[model samples]
Target: MSAQSPIVDLPCALIGFNDLVALLHALFIKHGTSPEVAAILAHNCASAERDGAHSHGIFRIPGYLSTLASGWVNGHAVPRVTDVASGFLRVDACNGFAQPALEAARALLVDKARSAGIALLAIHNSHHFAALWPDVEPFAEEGLVALSVVNSMTCVVPHGADRPLFGTNPIAFAAPRADGPPIVFDLATSAIAHGDVQIAARNGERLPPGMGVDSLGQPTQDPRAVLEGGALLPFGGHKGSALSMMVELLAAALTGGNFSFEFNWADHPGARTPWTGQLLIVIDPSKTAGQSFAERSQELVRQMHAAGLRRLPGDRRHRTRAKSLEAGIEIDAKALQQLRELAGE
Candidate 1:
C-alpha cells in the first residue's frame, strides 16, 4: 500500500484535506454507503491521497461505484462484533467495506489490548480495497505496536506455479517511538500492487522488468498486458510466496473469510474488490518489553541514521503528509472533476 510513483506532467490542482474528505464522503453516500460507512471510507481514502499513496487514493472511486451498482457489496451493512476471548475480538463485516468494521470495534480492541497486554481482531466477510497502513498506524500513535494483514483478489502467481492464485496480500506494521512519529511500513507480497499496475495501465506507463508476466506466461513490462489476463509475480520469489500463503491462512482461514481464489464475481461484472478478510494484532509493548519500548525504538532509529541511512520506513510519507497539510494535497485536475461529478456537484 505504501509504494507510490508520482504521475509527473499531469494537470494538477490543490485541495484541502477536509475538503477532499467531504467531497468523497458525499460521493460515497450518493453511491450507496450509509453516512457512517461513508465517513470512515472517505477519511481512509483522503488520508491515502494526502500521504501520496496515489494508487489507493481517489483512483479507486470508480471501482467502488461500480461494485455498489453491481450489488456486489452492502454499503449500509452494520458490523457485528463478537467478544470471543479475553484477548481476541471478531467482527463480521456483513459483506460491507472493512474500514467501518474496524471503526466499529476500535474502542473495544484498544480496551482489550490495554487490559490483556495484547489483543487480536479478526474481521471477516469484508471488502478491503484501501491501503493497509491506515488500519494499524493509529495504534502506534497511541503508544502501541500493531501488525495487520489482508488478502486481495487473486492476481499473483506463486513462485513455482504456472497460474495466478494468491492475492497481492499486503502486510503492515507500526510501532511507537519516543523521538517522533511511529515507525510504520506497508508492502504487498507481490512485486507490485495490483492497483499500481492499474495506475500504470491507465497512465500508459511501462513497469520495471520482472514485475509481471503476460497471459502467455512470458515476462512483460507492459502494465496493460499484465492487467489483461496476465499476472504479477512474488516480490522475492519463494519468500514472498510463503508470506502470501501465511497471509491467506491468517486473514482468510483463521477469520472465516473467503480465500482469494474462492470468491467468484462472474455474475457481478463491475465488482473490482475482493471479498475477503483481515487480521490485526495490537501489542502493549510496555507490558512485555520490560523497558521503555518507545525509547528502544528511538534508539534503533538513531543507530540507523548514524549508519548513513537517509530515510526510515515512513519518513517520506510523514514528510509528504506534513507538506500536504501545510499546502493542500495535489491531485490530477481531471480526477477531481470526475469526483465532483460523482458527488453530483
Candidate 2:
C-alpha cells in the first residue's frame, strides 16, 4: 500500500445505480438482513456514490453488516416523531440508521415550509448519515434555503487539549440558483474528514503536520496511529473548536443524544452505541422575494463568477461524478477484493 509500490487496479464494472443497489441488496441479504430493509439501505449507499460521496458509499457495507450482526442497530425499528409544535419537530430514531429517519423528517419540513414559510427539525438516536450536501441539495433546488448539522463519534481534540473531546461535526448550507447548480457549502469542523484519513491509510500516505496526533498525545504522520488511538485537530484552532462545541450542544444536547466527553466511539464494539443527532432547517424563498428571487440569485452568482472564483460549491463533485460514471468507480484492488469476499462473489 506504500507510494513506492505500483498502483493496483480493480476490475471496472459499468452499471447503473439500480444495478449497484441490487448487488448491495444481495450482499446485505447474505449477511442476514431482511430483504426489504436491505433494499432501502442499499439504495441509500448507491445514491451516496452517485452523488460523489465514495467514502460513505459501498465501502460502508461491511461495517453496517457487522453492526447488524452485533445488534447495535435494530434493523426492524421504525423512526417516530416524539414532538411537534409551531414550526419545529423532533424525531427519535429508536436505534436505526439516520438516513430513513432524516429523510422522513426532511420531507415533513419541506411540506410544512411550503405553507408556514419555514420549518425546523431535530433528530436523536440515529446512526451515521451520509454526505450532508445530498440531503440539502433537493431543498435548495426547490427554491428553499436549507441548513443541516450532524455530530459523529468523538475523534477531534479541542484547542490546547491533548485528549479527544468532540466529533468532527459537519454542517451544510444550500441556496438555490436560477441558472446553475445550487450554492452549497458542506464541511467538517476538523482539519480533515475522518474518511480522508482512512483513505490515506489505505494508500500508505502520511497526514500533513497538525492534522492529527498519536496515542501518546504526540504529533504523528502515521495514519494507523491516528486511526487507532489518536485524534484529528480542529480546523482553525479555537474557531474550529468553538464551532465543534456549538454543534455538540445543538445536535447532541438539544436533541437528547450523547455529547462532548460522553460521545461513543465507533471503533469500540462493546461501547455504548453512538446514537448521533442531527438538526435541519428550511426556509422558503418565495415568501420573501415573490417571483424575482431566482433572478437575484442568478445575478449574485454572475457577479461572484466575474470576480474570478473558478469553481462553485458543488461543481467539483459534479465533475467527479461525471468521470466516475464514464469510467466506472476505480477502487483499489485490495478494497475491491475485500468487498467481493464480503459479498461471497
Candidate 3:
C-alpha cells in the first residue's frame, strides 16, 4: 500500500492568487530556482489553482523543488529559439521549465503564423509541470488558433493491453470566437488523469467504473491500485490510444526529446523532473480564410446551443476563474503547510 498523505485530515484554506503566487515564488527561489524562472512558475501555478485545475496547482511544488535540488533541471537555464524553416520555430529549453520556453516562443510564433498562415514550434529539454491550455490560450486570445501537446512520464497503458507505456499525454486546442472569449479545451487521452488518481488516493476515494486496471493488468476501480502499480486506460479505447500515440510522437519524436519510457528510465526514481517535451502550433485564421474563420466557428457554436447543449469545455474554467478572482482560491491545508516549510517559514 502507498503511504497516506500528511494533509488527509488537515483543513482547507482560502487564499488569493497573489498571496499564493508570492508564497510559491519564495519557495522556488529558496530551492535555488532563478528569480525569473521562479516568477514564471509561480504565475502558472497560481493560474492553475485559480482556474480550478487542482492537479497542476501548488500541489506540484514538492516534485518541482525535488528536481531543482537534485539538479535534474536547471533553474537558471535559458530557452533558445530559432526559425528553422518558413513555418517551423524550434525552442530549446536547456533543461529548465516549459513556461518560459513557451513564453519566449509566443510572440515569434504568433508573428510567424500570421505571415505563413500557420507555424509550428518544437520544444525540448524541458520539465513541463502544468496544463497545456495556458500555452494555447494566449494565441487564441490574440485571434489565432492554437494547438499544443506534451508527453510526460508514462503512467498509462496502451489499448488492448496493460502495463505502462504512455503518459496521460494531453492535448490542448483553442480558437477565436465572434463573441465572448475564445473556445478552448485541454484533455488527457487517458480515461482518468494520473494526477486525478493521485488526488483520489489522497482523498481516500474510489475510482469510477472502467477507469483503469490494477497492477496485475486486470480492470479495477480502485484508485490505490491504479496509483501504486497499475495503469490507466485510454479514454475511448482505440481512438484515445491513437491520439496518445500522436501526442507522444509530436511532443517527443518530432521535438527530438526523450520519450515517456526514456524519461522514466533517465530519472533517479523520486523527487526528480520528468524531462518532458511539448509541441505548439499556431494558425492565423484570418490569414487562412479571411473573416469566414470566425463566422463559421461562431455558426458551429450557435448550432451547439441550438441543439440544447448549454456549455462547452472551457466554460466551467472561466466561471471558476471569475469566482477565484473575486473570492480567492482555496488550497488544501496540508499543501499550504508544506509550501510554508519549503520557504523556511
* Best model per lDDT: 1
Report RMSD (Å) for each prediction in the order shown: 2.8, 3.5, 2.2
- Residue-level lDDT tens digits of model 2 in 56-119: 6765665677677777777666778854866788888777767667765767788778878888
Q: Tens-digit lDDT track for model 3 on 1-345?
A: 123443566678888889988998998899988889989999888899999997777767767876777777889988999889879999899988888898888888888999999999999998887878888998888889999999988777888764788888999999988876789999999998777887888777999897898889888988988877888988998999999999999999999877888864344544445687899999988866455677778888999999999998899889999999999887777777777887888
> Ten consecutive residues with minimal summed lDDT in candidate 2?
1-10
Instruction: Give candidate 3's error at residue 159 in angstroms.
Output: 1.2
The TM-score obtained by model 3 is 0.93
Tell me which residue pairs clash in candidate 3.
none
lDDT (Cα atoms) of all candidates against the true structure: 0.93, 0.76, 0.84
Query: Quick one: RMSD of model 1?
Result: 2.8
- Model 1, TM vs. native: 0.96
Pairs of colliding residues, candidate 2 = none
**For model 3, what is the alpha-carbon lDDT of residue 200?**
86
Over 4 Å off, model 3: 1-10, 264-269, 290-292
- How close is every model to the real structure, measured as TM-score? 0.96, 0.88, 0.93
Which pairs in model 1 have colliding backbones?
Answer: none
**Span of ten consecutive residues with least summed lDDT in model 1:** 1-10
What is the TM-score (0 to 1) of candidate 2? Answer: 0.88
